[model samples]
Target chain A: MTDALVLLVVVPIAASLFPVALGGRFERIGWFVAAAMGLVHLGLSATVAAQVLESGVISYAVGGFEPPFGIELVADGVSAPLLVLVSLSTLGVLAYARRAGPHSNAFYSELALLTAGISGVFATADVFNLYVFLEITGLATYALVASGRSPRAALASLKYLFVGTIGASLYLLGVGYLYIMTGTLNMADLTGAVASVGYTSPAILTSFGLIVTGLLVKVAVFPLHTWQPGAYAESPDTVSAYISALVSTAAAYALVRIIYAVYTTKFLDEISLAGDALVALASVSIVVGAVLAVMQSDLKRMLAYSSVSQFGLVVAAIGLANETALVGAVVHLVGHAVMKGGLFLTVGVFATGLGVRTVEDFAGLAAKAPISSAAFAVLAFSMVGIPPAVGFVGKWNIVVGAVEAGAWSVAAVVVVSTLLTLAYFGRVIERMYFTAPEPEADAVSTDGGNDAVEVSFGMRAVVVVSAVAAVVLGVLGSDLITVIQPALEVYF
Target chain B: MIDLLTTHYNYIASILLFGIGLYVVMGSPNLVKKIIGMNIFQVGIFLFFVTTGYVDGGAPPVVGHGEETFVSPLPHVLILTAIVVGVSLTAVALALVIRIYDGYGSLDEDVIKEVQVDD
Candidate 1:
């Protein structure tokens, strides 16, 4: 299992390189290699998760050097499930991409690199290594966004690159500060060091501020979310779906790991101002994101903004920092990924088949494409936190956690946001099912343009699988909660 | 003042470099220049880590007799990894800049935006 852990992070990256290097000559073979590697990666991650559940925590020392010296890869209850989530989602996206079309060989390679980077970030126990993995993910995503043929896509990629660099730089600065205070980069060691020195010190506070601020930018927290809508709107539908599902979720997961694992609840209790400050920022993000999302005309852009709001809820739940709230945040992480991934993939199918870009363009979609539209409706309902969908389970936990934390105001914001989410999504649902199709020029020219393009069986398969996961995950909430609860025990 | 300069020179340099880089990233109109600023900022971080490893008048860290008086090599290794990351970032940023120039015929962000609007 120990050796297998290293393979989990390394194989996908190595395999990704092969496809890009040799894939041009052998297209089918390249995809086969990538898919095979993804399945192997999934299998290894699951094995690790099993071990983590049965045994306490698993630590792999790099190069035979122990903690506070060489780099370490640690998997606890917190990291194990996330590792599985990243691998599973990447595999799903890769499978989806295989039949979608012939993406540039370079593009697919970058996507594979991104998979490795995200997996590394989740598994590594060293803070600096985490930053390196972050860069890998960031660079790959920037390229992926730019791979779209549109000029707007290039522009969006540029903005994302700029902001993302700043975020990474700030995070590095925070790490520098932490290193100065603790003289160690190992997370387990740093936790002990931070607790020993007291969390109220100005240095620790400064580090916390820098780290949290940087992560907020990555997570696309409210005011810092200017780059996301454009990026999501302009990227190829397949790329947009995968990134929208993964990037912010990874950042949120990292933030939780840092706050709960690296800096214990005791440290946070000592620095009460820190928690309050985060809660305040999260509240602002939740309100602002939902409001902005409600105002967008473009379908993908609206979903992108909706993600900004959904992410805010995750951060806010984390800020609440109680056990129930933390579980809510984790559940939200997984739930939002399924719901958003399904929605984006469905939209991709619509855009490809119908050439539709705006909500207005979705008119009578339900009649034209019942199965795809049905899938979208289910996802939309899930996004609105309707019962028996995973979204509701996550949202309900957040509400309960907030109420328990005596944060009734935060709970109220969540309630209002859910309604607002429904209102915006409801407009689209109405347009697709009820309204007459507007005779747009593009619509007239192309036989519904691409909108008439039927989603492939394989594409439909991916959508149905994710949609079913959303419902099933919601129904079996107790099982997920049980898996996650052990993780929460370490933090709370 | 001289004592302060000598004692905190690395700190001063890190801050100065970081500020300059930040200014370029935010204030420059040219996209390429902004990328340059990013590089400068990263170099500042590199310096910060290297400085953290310094022990006054110490030799390089190696396992041998008389190596007791040596600065820690750990930060050096950490900065080495960071440097590789920095290089990768530079490559990606430059690639994006090239693409932007291709799309808009200018490296200036304002010009690019104007071109986009005119389109």
Candidate 2:
């Protein structure tokens, strides 16, 4: 039912409180509650996606209030994929976190809250409502990042809180500007209201600047990405994989929603500066992210940097603003989340089972943990744009989209960044398969030795499943494009 | 310039508050100061939203109050929600700061970084 759209956000939020309320007696029960809620959330997300894909965009006014006055929850092709991603990643990460954990009622509660926040962001039709959800996501994420054992995690989380709050506030300020100019907060209503004010108007331009800039910080695009690597690297492994997959992905998805739904392509056409700046930053992020990723010895930090590059492609696709490019952006967004999240989980398996946390520690990993190593290699190669993997599918679409839009520079960067991707992932692959295990690795292994290493069935299954999904989704790329086409038509 | 300032003094003041808050957050070495700066920055945005909802000689937006010009109630509602969000964020931030202080025995950002590296 269309009403399921609101349920997608509301159910998780209400469920999030249960874990904390039952904390003292049911400490370990948090995972079970979260898992159960995640399943329900996934079902709700699927129902919404199916209805939207079958029909068109599904818009629901909360409590039967009409749009442009009361808040609206919307789900279309764009949101459907992200909604599913948020739920799926939540479920997947909970599986991995079952054994590898800060397994507190509090942690699961935060995870459920994050699920609620991200789903809310995807579902909301009001700009100010988007801000509230962004904060909710921000708060949950900051807490999760701090949930790590180290004091460093608290510092990383604090830094993230400060930067992330500023970004969200800036977005709110932009909403304020838009509200003053158009006297409306609803995305659908603001589209017409913004156009009537003229794209070239100073207020409209300022709002666009503020909104996009704010979101870019959340997306961790290049220069604004300072809080990301530390947050990703320092957090508990489950937290890293979960946030790495969904948080920035949700923010980037919001970027797409705002650009297409509210500003429309006409604004980009009128203002060359806007599109150019986005493209420029994205290009820089791609190159710099890859370069930094290659320089990292820490595996988690490497993946964090790699996310910056991958999201660059997504943002670049959004900036290209063509039908094909937008398709590429969505495909890449989904692909990157799966691939990167899988990679982080795989790294966690190594860290937990083998005490291996650095690129150097990856040498001869295939011998000890064949399944995870193979999965890691598969994901890494997929990230390098190997065929039949979702990563290659996403990159191919983005490159084709970039060329179609005459964005030769972006296309070239897409190609070059693949090689840059290879440069980083390749070394890990080489270490995994080719190099001999270090003689002193036994001394270096955090758990004592390879003999003592014991990875749970759940952790191994999730990473392997993600690797398989990356390949399968790539094969089904055309079907995905077909499903999303109708939604794209409404905008382009 | 004077006329513009007179007409939009609230806007100007809000912008100034925004800039000052940002400067303190970025420029200060103290951890607590950063959180204070964050609150100030949020308050600036709240002020801007409230200013936008204001109307000259407007009555409060109460149902059936029968005022010809009533201030827009939406922005105020949104700001109320944001203020709640801001308070939660501050609470979480200070909790982290306390943990950080207990761990490293200092509240200075530079000192914490130094201690962190030494760890």
Leading candidate by lDDT: 2
Error of 2 at B64 (Å): 5.4
**In model 1, which runs have C-alpha deviations exceeding 4 angstroms?**
A440-442, A445-454, B1-3, B63-67
True contacts kept of 1: 0.68
DockQ of predictions, in order shown:
0.72, 0.94
Give per-residue lDDT, candidate 2, residue A288: 100
- The 10 consecutive residues of candidate 2 chain A with the worst lDDT sum are A446-455
lDDT of 1 by residue, B17-110 (tens): 9899989989999988898998898898789888988999898877664755899787888889889988987887788777778778998878
TM-scores, all models, native as reference? 0.96, 0.98
What does candidate 1's lDDT look like per residue over A1-492, in tens digits? 577677777887888788778876886666677678788988989999999888968889888998778889988776787888777787777767776744567776777788888888888888888888888889889988988887678779988988988898888888888988898889888999988777887888888888888888889998888889999989988888888988888888888888887887887788778888888888888888888888999999999999988998998888888889889899889889888988998988777777777887888889878988998999999989998999999999999999999999889999998998998899999999999786674456356554334457778888888888889989988788888888788777
lDDT of 2 by residue, A1-492 (tens): 687899988888998998899988776889988999999999999999889878878999988889988899999887898898888998899888888877789998999999999999999999988999999999999999999978999999999999999999999999999999999989999999999999999999999999999999999999999999999999988899999999998899889989999999999989988998999999999999999999999999999999999999999988888888888788888888899999999998888888888889889989878999999999998888999888888888889988888999999999999999999999999999999998887577854544343678999999999999999998998888887777887888
True contacts kept of each: 0.68, 0.93
* 10 residues in a row with least lDDT, candidate 2 chain B: B110-119
Q: Which ten residues in a row have the lowest lDDT in candidate 1 chain A?
A: A445-454
